[model samples]
Target: MTSELPPLPDTPPPAPTEPPAVSAHVPPAPAARRLSPLAAGLIGLATGAAIVGGTWAITANSGPDAPATFTLKGSFALTDSVVPDGNGGCGGTRGYDDILEGAGVTVYGASGDVIATGGLGNSTYDGDTYDCTFKVAVPDVPKGERFYKVEVSHRGTVQLSGKEAENGDFGASLG
Candidate 1:
């Protein structure tokens, strides 16, 4: 038996059309990669350090007395350099040593006035000295307030880890 089929519709079948239009132009840059925990921590630490350092430089100048005190602690490293002409107390005409005995940091108020001061004792590791840490009790930063500054000082010798960094005015936060 022959099967009868319906005639074709008036409209022709759809054509094999090309894919939808897509621009060849480069897309926006991909989002930044995520950081590992360790990397993220290190970055955070570095950023915090930079901010504090900047604040320290900006706040080294004299300012109105701060009613609140700030206890600031931070780490510092010195680059090798020639010893100053002074011949005593970590300073000698000869090349200086990287390790230092007199290393300290002073906190300043927003107005660039001295607030609190603390010393960084020498940190020795396998007969090598380093500036590792410091703790100071500054009685000038008014509590509850944040923005501030500081003056970091480290008296070290040449041929050693120390730099004649200028007294800077660093802008910072009270954290």
Candidate 2:
């Protein structure tokens, strides 16, 4: 008894599906555009400059008007019969040793608050006038007060109008 094989169908089996072909030469991801070292440095510098400029502008315009200030200038004249040593000070003349030199000068606000302090400069003696004159300058004294009080050494405080303080033509006299 011979076994018979089944008859093959006429329609051919469906063709095998294939995966799409991949390109081997994919263009390297566009070389990331790189900045030159000089360009990078310039950009960094510009950014830093912009930040600094912005900060400066904010600070320069934000604060109260620099507390309007003026140099309180004045002079002290001491009338004495003692002859000067021709130097800036008395220098042992008549038992006086530069009494005006380095003397404390104080500025007081309207509220009696101490505003500024300075020392008297050297004294110059005038032969004809018999006056030992010295100059004192209290720099950067705040303005806008109705009045100011100025005192030299232990001398009493002298009240001055705003205009007088601004003009800076006030002083103390001692004999």
Candidate 3:
């Protein structure tokens, strides 16, 4: 036997469409104001001048805080095959402490406790040329790692102390 079912409903109708409207009271958009060529050029020149002036000020205004002072002099004679000390140097041959007086020189840790003490000596090169000797013996410098400093007192005062490599080498740090 077949059972009866209800019938389907019809689709709804479409709605009406209309064009968008504008308001007569609203004003039109304004154009951007353009700068004159002369004005633009002057502005660019001023900007460039400002940048250059800033750069000049920065470069020219560098202050006077310089790094530490150190100097070393020695005979590089191959025949005088004097290698450096335990720190890769050796020189009782010829070296200057400080041409200027009060030039302080200090050597830190080395092998023994005996730090470097400075003094004057004399050396004879391959020829009969005599050389001035400035020596320093470190009294308590550590063996493997060491540090030293050589400072000059202002502009005068000669330093007769720093006569060894551990004393000073342009502020070099030894390992």
Best by TM-score: 2
Better of 2 and 3 by TM-score: 2
Stretches > 4 Å off in candidate 1: 1-70, 81-99, 125-142, 154-175
Best by lDDT: 2
> Could you tell me the TM-score of candidate 2?
0.59
Task: Compute the lDDT of residue 48 as modeled in candidate 2.
Answer: 100
Clashing pairs in 2: none
Query: What does the lDDT read for residue 95 in candidate 3?
Result: 38
Tens digits of lDDT, candidate 3, 1-175: 5697776668766576676676668777798899999999999999999999999899886866544333343222223323233433233323332321123344333332323333222222323322222322223333234443332222222222333543432322110
The TM-score measured for candidate 1 stands at 0.30
Alpha carbon deviation, residue 52, candidate 3 (Å): 1.9
Using all chains and alpha carbons, the TM-scores for the candidates as numbered come to 0.30, 0.59, 0.25
lDDT tens readout by residue for model 2, 66-112: 67889898887777654576664542235344455787889999999
